[model samples]
Target: MKKILIFSASIGNGHNQTAKAMQESLGEQGYSSMIIDTLEYVSPTFHKILLESYMNLLRLSPKMWGKIYHNSERSRLIEINVLMLLANKLKKLINSVKPDAFIATHPFASCMLSVLKGRNNWSIPIYTIITDFTIHPSWINHHIDYYFIAHEQLKYLIDIYREDPEKFKAMGIPIMKKFREPLDKEKLRETFGLKNNQKCILLSGGGLGLGSMEKVLDGLNNIDLPLKTFVLTGKNQKLFRKVSKHTYRHEVVPLPFIDNVHEYLHVADLIVTKSGGLTTAEVLSKQVPMIVHNPLPGQEERNSHFLLNNGCAVHATVSEQLIYFIRELLYNPIKVDHMKQMAKRIAKPNAAEDIARFIMEDMASKAVSKVPLGGE
Candidate 1:
């Protein structure tokens, strides 16, 4: 069996989630794989500082983060220097692992691996998985063998920077296998104590619980509709406690950090979430209409734009607008159905399986080419 190396960073859940999905898929295909957090491997101090700074920036001032992201696009020299600094550590890992192929789910990993592959003259294929809907300039690297993107529009965006259209594949974002499996809505609702007749709205703050859960729940309670809300505060104990104390006109179920999020998504008629890449992909896979709330100003904002442009989601910057959008969707089920249909059109539930199969086929072809014509 061949071994695969997947590198990801822990800045956010999306990157690690994507790596795990690919690992599971490859495992099912009879391959062994390892997933490593790049920053954790390179420098623990740098990783801690970067992760804390990122969370603080997003919470305190998203616009500032946006400015940093935009400025970094033009800071190619600085990015190159950073990659050079980390090249030795990455090269050591590659040598120690001696894997057949490498995959990177984070931009930092991708950039560093690309540089190391070139410097060491390694022949192993290196694939980059773009975790977001939009392609950032920092992700562009000439040494990458393949670029897996979330959508076709992103391919076009990357083409402006690198003119190799064939190198790009719009495979959608790889999500957990559970999301791809068929879910029985009635059974899920019953298991979760949700009423079948009432509309269910799932309010998620992503893995870190970054959004305003209490305020959103309060606004949702004001909507004069017969609805049941399932709130996932996601490791934010304070937010969970605050939401649990409040009583609303409708039924409110508050949960903190669940492993079975897909089951909750299965029972929901609609979702209210901040537009993180993985969350948006999961919602789209479930074909549930979404109300995006307070997306952080960088990739989340771009993810929001993609969803809104595609008509599968509505953006709400404030509590009143969120309530209004919920009422609108609930009162008009036709519109909700339309959004669901749009989601179904764009959803790629089998992306991880597809990617795994593609890599296996490519490897087989290369192996066959190396064989002699007459078995000499």
Candidate 2:
């Protein structure tokens, strides 16, 4: 059994979830995989400060976040130094695991892997999975063996970032194998205690559950729609309780940290969510249309554009717009059908298998090259 190391951070839930999903994916394909949260391995104080500061900035001044994203592109020296420190720490972890290859789901992981390749002469192949549809300059690095992009348009974007075009493989987003299998909508609805025929709308604020869930739920109260609503307040106990206490006559379910996300996706006809890469990918895979709320500055904005252009989702800038968008989606069957069809066409059902196979083949070729021919 070949061992593989998957690295991610805790700043957001998507990164960690992606790492876990990839592990499961590899297992189904008959490969052994392990996940490590690099943040936990490091000093807790440093991780706490960094994560809190980032979330505070995202919540308070997103424009500043946007500027940082823009600056990351041009400030090569700064990025390189940060990468050096990250690489040194990750190098120790990699040496212990001695993984056949490294797979990174976060941009920082890619940056650090590049540094290891540059400064430490590390030769293990590293594959960076670009979780979002739009490519950022920070995600582009010279030493990565390959890039698994969300779509073909991003391949062109990477060209502008100066990466060789041949390195990109349009493998869609890596999701759990459970999502790839066809779901029984009626059975899923029953599992979640949802009505058989009534419309179900799933509202999620990504893994942090950072968005204004209560505010969005309150706004929905203003609209006179007859759909059942489900809000996934992930690891956000305060938001969960606040939303749960609300006395809405309509069927509203408030869940905290559910393991069966695909079941919820299967039952939802319309999903209102933040434009995180993982959320958008899952929604797309389930063929559920989306209404997006406030997205984070850089990658989230790029994801929003891709979904909008692809007819998989509609954007809502403010609370009112989100409410109105839900109303429209609930009432219009034709538009809903159109969005669902578009989503099905774009969903990559075999992404995990493709990625696993890619890694296995790369490892095999490398091993073969080291053989001594005509050994006595």
Candidate 2 regions off by >4 Å? 76-78, 205-225, 368-376
Candidate 2 per-residue C-alpha lDDT over 1-376 given as tens digits, one digit per residue, 9 for 90 to 100: 7777887778677788778778887887677888767655645676788789888888778899888877776765244775566567766666666677778887777777777766655667788888877777767776898988888766667667666887889987788888878878887778777765577888885433434565666667765656678888777788778777877767778888888888888888888877888777877888989887878777798899998998989998877778888888888999999999988888776677788888777788878222111111
Q: Please tell me which predicted candidate would have the highest lDDT against the true structure.
A: 1
Question: What would the per-residue lDDT of candidate 1 be over residues 104-177, giving only the tens digit for each residue?
Answer: 99888888888776776667788888888898877778688888889886766865775588878898889999
- Give each model a TM-score: 0.94, 0.90
Query: What TM-score number comes out for model 1?
Result: 0.94
- For every candidate in turn, the CA RMSD to the true structure comes to 4.0, 3.9
Q: How well does model 2 score by local distance difference test?
A: 0.76
Displacement of the residue 2 alpha carbon in candidate 2, Å:
1.9
**lDDT per model vs. reference:** 0.82, 0.76
